[model samples]
Target chain A: MTDVLVVADHRRGDLRDVSYELVTAGRELADETGGDLHVAVISGTVDEFADKLNREGVDAVHTVDYGEEFNHGVYTQATTQLYDELAPQYVLTPNSVNGLDYAPAVANELDLPIVTDTVALETDGETLTATREMYGGKVETTTELEGPAVVTIRGAEWPAAEGTGDAAIEAFDADIDEDALGTTVNGFEEVGGGDVDISEADVLVSVGRGIEEEENLEIIEELADALDATVSASRPIVDNGWLPKNRQVGQSGKVVTPDVYIAIGISGAVQHVAGMKGSDTIVAINTDPNAPIMDIADYAITDDLFDVVPALTEEFH
Target chain B: MKILVTVKEVATVEDEFEIEGTEIADQYLGADLNEWDDYAVEEAVQLQEAGIADEVVTVTIGPEDCEQTIRQALAKGADRAIRVWDDALEGVDLLDVEAKTEILRGVVEEEDPDLVLSGVQSGDDSWGATGVSLAEDLGFEWAAVVNHLEHDLEDGIASVRRELEGGVEELTDVELPAVLTIQTGINEPRYASLRGIRQAQRKELDVQSLADVGVDEGVVDSDLELTDMYEPESESDVTVWEGSAEETAGELGDLLRDKGVAP
Candidate 1:
């Protein structure tokens, strides 16, 4: 039987939501392969993290106690050691900043093929068929990979795993080579210190390329104020210097799951959708009724954002 | 110090893309330098201007047509350009991250740069793996999705701020001769001036084959096979609102209030 291994991702002692999402993905793949699902958690205190991951669909939780924060050297050593012992058919990780840092090194060391930012996966006999987007989500490509590979799943693609069970927890020690590590973490710096974090806001008023110029952001800010929502933007607005990078929402920016997300003049590219698709309710105001964003929106208004935004602001006020 | 920046040329497609069998329609408006790479080019140029590095070399793996993209980088202040291509690579699946990484490894070996920079992800394939995998092969320290970077030539170390999920950023220090995949909006890339463009035309634009880079043709074989390519299906449960702007806005507000999102 082919087993599936999922590497849990965490930060500052908290398990990331993607860890459960990886379980959801791993469970499905494991069932298809007629095998058990295994989870590997590497942290300073493994048992605390391991206990939280002993949920249904997982057969075992492998814990490796390392430094407090994620260290690339420690992760690489622990993962490779775990892979050697488990010898699972597939290893899955989140396509996050931390996951991507050491995943490639592990794959390279093991001579395993890897695919990144995979949105969908299916089993074809012993092989795995993965789906990803290209051209800013304008095109979708389905690729078939040989078994016994490593893959990174995109956030929000699969629902978070739920239900509970008492899976066994096991600890493993890794041989970390200090001399091999050439990078050191100096600490984290907030992108915009003291600025409102749009990701934490319950309601978001997000503008896109249609905002046209920096001066036009005032209207968006006004709408945000009326609703008590925070103002965010798509990548183009940030790239143009119309907004700070911290305010951008997309694959290259923040992945937010606000209660309400109001997208103005946004075309809803796959990259942008990957970031905010988890919003409880999405509303789109665009001139094109056929825009991709309209398809996923709960409520889509096919009117000029200039007119619709002000009207919405006035109505809310 | 020498810095190497990797650039790519990508096709920009608009509405009505035709799928000609296993390939996209041959006709395209035009090709330009990949948007993300522009930030890498800008950072390299700025580093050179700041005297952090004396030479800025740019490289790409594409057809002869990609020279246009290299010239654009040179005009942006890159000192030289190298294009790696061969007939064996023609019609090769571009999403082959492993093979592409190996090809780039060949170029990096030849350049022997003190620092390597590339876009966090390409606009076309968007795999976002080449640079990191290359770093692995070279046994160099690396950081991905870096937005802010500073180098200390004397100390032989570089400090970078990486953009992570949920608007969080991490500060890390890596020994020199590392690799960094630059994120967009890191800096504003400068436009090419008339004099700069003229100077770029005279700069060295070297074209090398896979053999010249010490990579065997057989290494181009891809690990993954493309089964299909198409547009995604649109969501079917969308509710399209039709009314005047004011009326629609009122309806939207009512909906939000009913959903308990608005007070």
Candidate 2:
């Protein structure tokens, strides 16, 4: 049977949510096309992870533990060698920093067809049809695979599944070229040294260009404080020197799935949407209701910002 | 002071794209610069303007049509551009991520750049996979999704700030002559000014071939290939909410929250 392979991503030991999403989507494709779903785990003692994969409909888990930390060369070599051996019909990966770098290399080596940022996938007899977001998620396009395929899926494109796979863990010895790859991780030095989980926040008070001046941002900070929320902004605010670039949100910014995202004085841009679109609730507070942010917003306050923001902050208090 | 930048000409698949018989029915995109490389070109220009780099050479591998994108870069003020020509490469998938990386590795060897810059990704197939692959081949220090970047040629050091969850990833002490994949907002990528565009028409574009570069392209045989290209599918169902201000706000919020996309 044709097999679908998913390369799972993780930090120290535990698995991330995106891995499960890949399995769910991969399983769907495999089932429809008379194929079996497989997951590749490049980690340390990932038996628990393999069991978890089985629950997500994976037929088998290819586990390779080189060390406690991640090394690109190790993973790339193992994956490349495994694909050469398994010769699966389709290879799937999470569209993250790791997948973007190496999936193409393996696909290139094997001369396999590859698609990235796929949100939807289907099969028709002998072909694979995939969907990708374009123009800031404003449009979606379907693509047919040219041959055997390797692809990466955007985050949140598929929901996690509950269960039913063989869950067998298989460890394979693959040759890796260590000399060809260098650059060691000395240790983890957190950026800005903040342990905040922007992705899991309960409330997000985000600002965009609507706030106008850097000084005016204090008004937003006040509103955020009133609701006890964190502050975020669109890419333009940072580009204009109004806010630190770290506050910007979009395709290039942090992808947050917060419970409530309050866009104050922000006109939602496409890049911005790619980051926050997955949030549980989106509230747009802009003077122009026709702004792009309104299209996806659940609550929009259209009065002049000078009038409404104070009202929001006041009401929250 | 030195940076290697990779850019390509991608004919964006636009117009009425359709799928017929497992093939991507040709949609007329006409020829234009690949959509994502513009950000790469712009990022290189910004680094030079910000006084981050002493030199920036824009590079690409393709036919004469690829020159269109090279000049597009010159129009925005890149110092020089390199075009690796191989007429036999028509429809060979230079747009593919792995193929593009192999092509770039050749240029990197000849130029010996301190830093290699490619568009965060390309537009065709729009997969955004060049920086990682090139970085892997060269074994250079690298970073992607760069919103802010800084480099010190004298110390052979680079610092990149990537946008991550909640805060930022400020990676320092990264070696110079590294590979950088830039994000869209890196610096409000400048457009080709009227004069700049006109001047780019006359800029020197050095053309080289895979054979002349001491490399053989035969190693990569097209294994996984595209038998067809076609238009994306569309779903007709619509969920439009209409009403007064509160009614609209409430309705939109309810819909989003109902979808578990909002609170």
Model number with the top DockQ: 1
**Shift in Å, residue B67, candidate 1:** 1.1
Runs off by more than 4 Å, candidate 1: A193-202, A209-228, A239-242, A257-259, A267-274, A277-280, A287-292, A303-317, B236-238, B243-246
lDDT of 1 by residue, A1-317 (tens): 76888999998778888899999889899888589899999975689988888878889999987777887777877888899999988889998888888777778778888888889988843789999987777778888878688889987778888888678888877777878878788887666634456777789999998888789899999998888788999988887777777888877788888888999999998789867877888999999888878768988888988898999899877
The number of the candidate with the highest lDDT is 1
Sort candidate 1 into its docking category. Answer: medium
Candidate 1, B1-263: lDDT as tens digits: 99999999987776567776545686843588988899999999999999888999999999987787779999989999999989998877654767777888889998899999999888877878778788988887888888899755468788888877666788888887889999887888899999999999999999999899999998777778888898777564778889999999998898878878785
Candidate 2: residue A169 Cα off by (Å): 3.2
lDDT per residue (tens digit) for residues A79-128 in model 2: 88878777777888878765665676566556566788888887753577
Candidate 2 lDDT by residue in tens digits, B63-162 = 8866876788889888888888775565564245556667788888888888877766654446776677677666676665565665344566666655
lDDT of 2: 0.69
- Minimum summed lDDT over a 10-residue window in model 2 chain B is located at B229-238
Provide per-model DockQ scores.
0.64, 0.24
Clashes of each: 0, 29
Q: After superposition, how far is residue B48 of candidate 1 from its true place, in Å?
A: 1.4
Clashing pairs in 1: none
